[model samples]
Target: MKIAWLTLCAPLLLSACTSTQTVGYGPNLEPIPGSITYGGQPRTKLTKAPVGSIVPHQFFDDFGHRVYETYVIEPDRSLRLTSRRIDYDIFND
Candidate 1:
């Protein structure tokens, strides 16, 4: 019974933090990815994403200085970092 309980909960524990979350348009002004403008009006209405797109991406500040790279944060508070210069797949290839 104890083994069964641990087996059932193991998947639940692992699944939650297996994803990446993104922060956009804060002090680090990454280009609003997938952003669209409603061009038919006098005022352009911008539609911004809530973050976390797996799209090959990059970041910059409002002043256009490259600052951070996208990453997945582990539940243990470790970083799985990504960047244009470092292709993680290169090793696999």
Candidate 2:
């Protein structure tokens, strides 16, 4: 009787230990080349974008740190990078 009860509860207990949330940004954007370079390197390449368009970019460093950047495309096809934090709140209120 005890073994049967344990078997049923074991799966439930182990499921909570699993990491359901994945690291880094979601599967929507791609990383920019040479963006993860060191400080002494040249200026990072700016992604091209059309006017009034928002582009999302992700960067990963050697220390496993991730950065999410949003760029607003100017009228001249220049990208303006912003380091704004994204809100993960499900409810706006």
Cα RMSDs, all models = 15.6, 10.5
Per-residue lDDT of candidate 2, residues 10-66 (tens digit): 998877553223333433434344343223323544455447687776654443444
Once model 2 is optimally superposed onto the true structure by TM-score, how far is the C-alpha of residue 54 displaced, in angstroms?
Answer: 0.3
Model 2 alpha-carbon drift over 4 Å, by segment: 1-49, 84-93
Q: Among all windows of ten consecutive residues in candidate 1, which has the lowest summed lDDT? A: 33-42
On the 0 to 100 scale, the lDDT of residue 71 in model 2 is: 61
Local accuracy of candidate 1 as per-residue lDDT tens digits, 1-93: 999999999998776534333444333332232221113212422234323433233444343333345443334333334432212221222
User: Which ranges of candidate 1 are over 4 A from the true structure?
Assistant: 21-55, 58-93
The per-model lDDT (C-alpha) reads 0.37, 0.49
